[model samples]
Target: MNPRALRAAGPAILLVAATLTVFAALAYGGAADPLATGDPGPFVRWGLPVAKLVVNLSAAVMVGSLVLALFALRAGEKEFDAALDVASIGAAVFTVSAGTVGFLTFLEAFNPQLSAGPEFGAQLGSFLTSVELGRTWLITTIAAAVVTILAFAIRSWTASLFTAILAIVSVIPMATQGHSGDLASHDATVTALSLHVVGAAAWLGGLVLLVVLRPVLTDRALPAVLARYSSIALVSFVVVTLSGFARTLSSIGAWDQLGTPYGGILAIKVAALVSMGLLGAWYRQRLIGRVATAARAARSFWTLIAVELGFMGIASGAAAALARTSPPFTETPYSTTPAEILTEEPLPPELTLDRWLTSWNVDLLWAFVAGFGIFFYVAAVVRLRRRGDRWPVYRTVFWVLGMLLLVWVTSGPINAYQEYLFSVHMLGHMLLTMAIPLLLVPGAPITLALRAIAKRDDGSRGGREWIMWAVHSPFARVVTHPLVAAAIFVGSLWVFYYTDLFRWSMYDHLGHVWMVTHFLLSGFLFVMSMIGIDPVPYRMPYPGRLVTLIAAAAIHAFFGVSLMMQSGLMMAEWFGAMGRTWGPTPLEDQYIGAGIAWSIGEIPTLITAITVAIQWSRSDERQQKRADRHADRTDDAELHAYNARLARIAERDAAGR
Candidate 1:
């Protein structure tokens, strides 16, 4: 490996070692107590513990495999490649060892006593016998190890073939080993656990692979690669986030458990992930500039990767703990039933003050209004496309109203309360940041304003000169540039959410309004910069636009995942003050809320990304075809001119004769 690659390896190794040590400590020190025969509870002698151990160990192995895949993708530096190979092998070995140890641990946890007595031993034996063949963690681990080794050793199509085989084998054991296989028993826990494990592996594993490969990527080719991965990441992020929430809800049984210790820890995990995501967005935005300039930003890039990986590790650790922790299915002193809260008597209408319009909701209305105005503006533009009519007052009114309405709506009471309502907040965020901006860009509001002003023609040379200067000013160029708008939209999201500013913004009506306003404006700027919804001052090349969209979406996905894994409600106190009764424990509600934020918020954004991709591709194709035709015409014209010149020279010689 080169010096840079070698330096990269150091961090990777350290990260791997730290992760293994943590998991090993948990395994050795965190083992549960052994129970005697005839234990009162329905604990599955060894089945549950064994299954858990297998899953955790398997996860470690998967992580190792991902590290290898990353190295393969980033094979630019030979030394780094060699180091990654070694690390990959080591990771594989660790996975096998961990799996072996976990299996033994499971056996010991479940069947410590060999006695075939009437009470516990008999029941345990019966349960074990009832389990299907090839259901043990031992089988799954061996299969995964074998496949991983083959994938490492082979080249060409065989590697992918083996990888597929391994993935399938991994699932079989997961299906059979857990309580989920006992379908007759209707075990929700096992089913939920199985889904959760699979989804997490896909999502986290993909992220690790992407991060590792990102460093060695060529600048010219990075956008396409990133775009492909962005799509994959989006799907994985959604699946993992939704499945995680489902698993949590099923395990916890009620919203009240959110206040419990386990729920609190889970919340922390979610928040950490969200924070990491915001960082990812920053990294993405920065990387775009670096890529465009062909500058080496390896150090900064690695730093961000390290941070992202660290958070992923934390989230994984929290998941492991959650698996071990007991859910609040049983009654507790602080329990506040879901039904009661959902059906609670409404507060007396007479005592109501101002209506509670959250920032998100207000933003939603603003988005709708802005959308309507843009639609009308577009209609007017299309109608006037055939005729160069002077600009109408009504059209100008529509444009100004649309802009003002969006700004004011995002800055009002609706924006303030959005954070309290997770789904609504996310909705507001999407509209303000993604949807509304799309509308604004197509309106060509700046171009329209300039045209309206210039039409007055006061006949003063100075006034016209000033208008021209303003139109061509540096400030105008900066705001109209795709890069600048992207910076504003993405930067605002990160700044608002990551700092104390986010917390402070959640506290009051005005703060909320300001936050929403910023979100909408930033979002509008970003979309306008990337896509020419309206006539931009200057448009980015199609390729550049594609990169911007893909990179921004990836950043957004990271943010959503982070939010989903937050450990505590960042705004729990704020919600409490708002008279929002989320049962006795706010943790579960918060988790659910984050899930809403991550999953629901992503749907519209992803759709937008897809649309952008399709449109960009079409535009590029058309431009290419047009260029080819123009080139052909120019060549023909040149040939004709050359022939005519030759004829003239020949005719002059004939006249002299």
Candidate 2:
């Protein structure tokens, strides 16, 4: 097919393919089978998935177009505007589809009579307001509507970026409903499904972007833009692949279960993904460079893009069906104990020396963050080395160590038991706020990034541009300021533990994410203000640094001591109620956690004070060396001039006497 025709037909092909596949899969899986009681009819059954398919496709285009506009296309240009226009249109569709899905879901779930009567309206309103599933879809619909307006109104870089983030977030509620896996797999499933959805959006949407905007992709610009898009697609593919694996593991109980209806749909999706990945990584990748100069390669690449779109349609359709299909079994055994009832997870084996080293429950989000963190850092170092620009070996080591430690803190024993064990939670907090920052600050990641990443001459802002903007942005200046950083660092420790923030973090996933981010960023900023090599707006003298550290440490110690002195358990309903036959009693564990905060936390402060002193000494020695060098170069002209002025004044005074 001609490129123009193919581009126009891409969405149609995907829609038709998805439509065909979803009903067939639904039939085979018995998801659309008649209910034994309170059946909402076939229209409700069929319309929901169709609406969801549109939501998935439209979400992809909206988010993908915005992301591609940021990374791949130049700003203030036709192609860039076109991308935003595409996103706006996609968001509009997403809003409508999501709203339809929400409404249809209500009908399917509640079997409310389709009517405009007050009674029917009241029932629908209660469902939308009172039910979790209803609320999730409602929020998704409203978020999509907001994204629609933002995407239409915003063309500037920052606005478009924020709009893109909102678009991504809008799909999260739907992704959360991806699998009905065990509660044991809740965090992992949620994280993985969210990533898979977002990544697949970018990958599929970028291709749609290329086809739909073919007129603007000039020969000279096409190669570079395609190359950039390819890079984004590659990263997306990796994320999708990994996250899909995690979701799959949670869904399929055993190898034998792969023959089940859910498994059949999963297998089809997997095949589509693998095929798409190969096409993207191999054929399309090779053709992107040649497409500018070679006409045959251009045609071949566009054809391959069409093929990938079909595969995406298959994957998207399969995914929607799989979400509705019942899995073979679940990992959540029936929980009877209070600990299990409250936490939605079984009580881990009693906290012990061996478990700290051995226990693991992977949090995919942070693992991916750390994994990519290490990969890119190493790549930057290699890029510098190849260019004969040397980065310190110790910096690289510290960076890797920091990332490794981050992975462990997030996904290791600390994460597994932090919810159940107060001492473990406090230990993780101290490490996150103090020790990890100590290791990470020395890495000088910002310095390395500025040196390693090439500057973009084009109108588009790449990684370097974004980094510089963020550092110099007003928010950074305020947060990085010494007094502000110190205040937040100290204030948050008190504010978090004493306020409902602690309870929120324990109960809500979003709250937990916010808690971790707040501490890590606050810690990093405080440490950076003190000893980090990265450029900041301001820094105090060495003595002042020491004083600040001392004051913060004193407050920290006081906080710890106060916690230890508390007679009652914090969040007593939670910490006190978990029916654990484990190590220490609740009160004793709280004391142990407070002890960790007081003693172990103070060690990092001591280390920082020592580091400051050593840095001060080294700075002074370097100043003296510079002074001696100046003396050797110019016979101490500055010193001689000062002395001569003093002598002249004395002689004049004597003459006057």
Candidate 3:
């Protein structure tokens, strides 16, 4: 191999070897055991996890490279091309490894022989076509294959973005596969696993991309690229850490269980993760600035990166083993009630004021999002201040408050009882769509980000660049248009509840995520169109803004009134089926929800309208002040013209008389 290529490939090869060795040892010693009765032999037992390891690593490469490419690397550059090539290779490996896992899984479950018999072929066909698990793997394999081709072919920013998304989606099937025996809380487990896998991949893959691209990058460009990547890595680390903890908690309950083999492996993973985090912090704090300029520092940085890869390998390996490790909570196999069979959580205690405040189901996804959102925002503000830039304190406060409220709504009582109580669901909905955005929009986070983040002048893009692109893009302009925003805001209320979308959110975890995202976005757009301080493609005139607000409020109120007038319960099968003995009947709860929609929901809309009016008044005052300034500059030319016209009319009238 050539010297430069060898240098780039060596670290990754060693890292993979280290990961596989550690993973296989852990899997064999701690968790992996061939099924005693329907044994699929050592091949299936060992091959599955190794396959999974390949899947994980490949996914990281595919996702991380695409993300880094989109965010940091410039198109038509050698570094960008190298990243895409790595992504394509990763996708190819992902495709093959995923298919192998599917085959191994089929062997493990059905113990099918390799004979060319018709019955065997039919059984295989049924497994691939009829079974959900088999279908999942099949789809994932196919998607990976597609991504492989696309990653090789596409190099543009938008295409790479889509490729990244496709790579992330390919892992979802794997996320849904693990811990399947626990049917009741499968949603939580699935959500946690999905987040964990995605986060870990991005974290691992981005670092690997940096290592691979070291040769291609120039000394001048490396630090800025690293800086951009550091943000993504930081966010990825937060997500992984939080999701891993949540997944572990769901499996291992008591503190004493930490002594078990499963817990030992988990501890090892945690230690490795902590070590990597510290290493990352050291890099950011000490080495990130100097690596680009100082020769000795650059060498030290590469050495540190190699060590960090070692730690990442350990973590990744242990994670694979831990998936195979049987949890203590699942060991006892205690009898479960029907509710436990259905919901995966025990029926929550009676809802009370105190319970509403204190209860926690721990939706780690949203919780971490909130936590990181607050942290990064505060960090950005602090960064600005340290550099002698001024940022409004109120924006920070509003953002923090909004995020805290989001956490409460997602992880607290509203989340706990939303499935059982329509009123609580509506309350959460209102908060997500109205109250949260009310605060968040006024916070003007996009503005803060634009101001606080440094502008990237190189061919590459960073957070500030992306944020600017998003705000000014054709899609953004279309969506953020006052009319479009208002239509979406008012239209969602009817479409969400009156259709199957509400029920889908109730039953499906992914659907629930979509619901939250949709509402949050719609609300943000609407609020931004009204009184947002951030720059947009276009905003309506102040009177038009007020008019939009009034129209949206009226439509929103009418939606609530329509709900209040409903004769029957919405999603009776899902919400009504949750057997709750404590609170209102399903119909009465629906009525309460309608009331919340009609009365409480309008409070924010009213506040928004009032805010719009105040903004309108201030806008007019600003216009008048601008006119005065113009008059001062031009010696009142408009007034002089008016006077001339008046004099001419008076002269004409006098002559006629």
- TM values, all candidates: 0.40, 0.98, 0.93
User: Which sequence of candidate numbers ranks them by lDDT, best first?
Assistant: 2, 3, 1
Question: Residue 531 lDDT in model 2?
Answer: 91
Per residue, candidate 3 scores C-alpha lDDT tens digits across 1-657 of: 332554666556646755675566555555457566888888778778878877888888888888888888998898998999999998999999989888888888899877889988898878888998789889999999999999999888778888888998998878887664453356677888889899888888888888888777888888988987887888788888888877887788889998888778788889988998998898888988998778778777777777787888888778777767777677323436544544556678789989977887667778878887998899899998999989889999999999999999988889888877889989999999999999999788888888888887787778887787778789998999999999999999999988989878877778988998899889988998888888889989888988888888788889888988889778777666667788888899898999899899989988988998888788789999999999999999999999999999999999999
Model 3 stretches with alpha carbons more than 4 Å out: 1-30, 180-185, 292-294, 331-338, 632-637
Top candidate (lDDT) = 2
Candidate 1: stretches off by over 4 Å = 1-91, 94-98, 111-134, 168-172, 175-195, 210-227, 285-298, 330-657
lDDT of 2 by residue, 247-330 (tens): 888878689999999999999999999999999887654888898788898788888888888899999999889888888867
Give the range where candidate 2 is weakest over 10 consecutive residues by summed lDDT: 176-185
Residue 588 Cα positional deviation in candidate 2, in Å, after optimal superposition: 1.2
What is the lDDT of every predicted structure here? 0.52, 0.88, 0.83
Q: How well does candidate 2 score on lDDT at residue 398?
A: 91
Candidates 1 and 3, the one with greater TM-score = 3
Best by TM-score: 2
Q: Which model is ahead, 1 or 3, in terms of lDDT?
A: 3
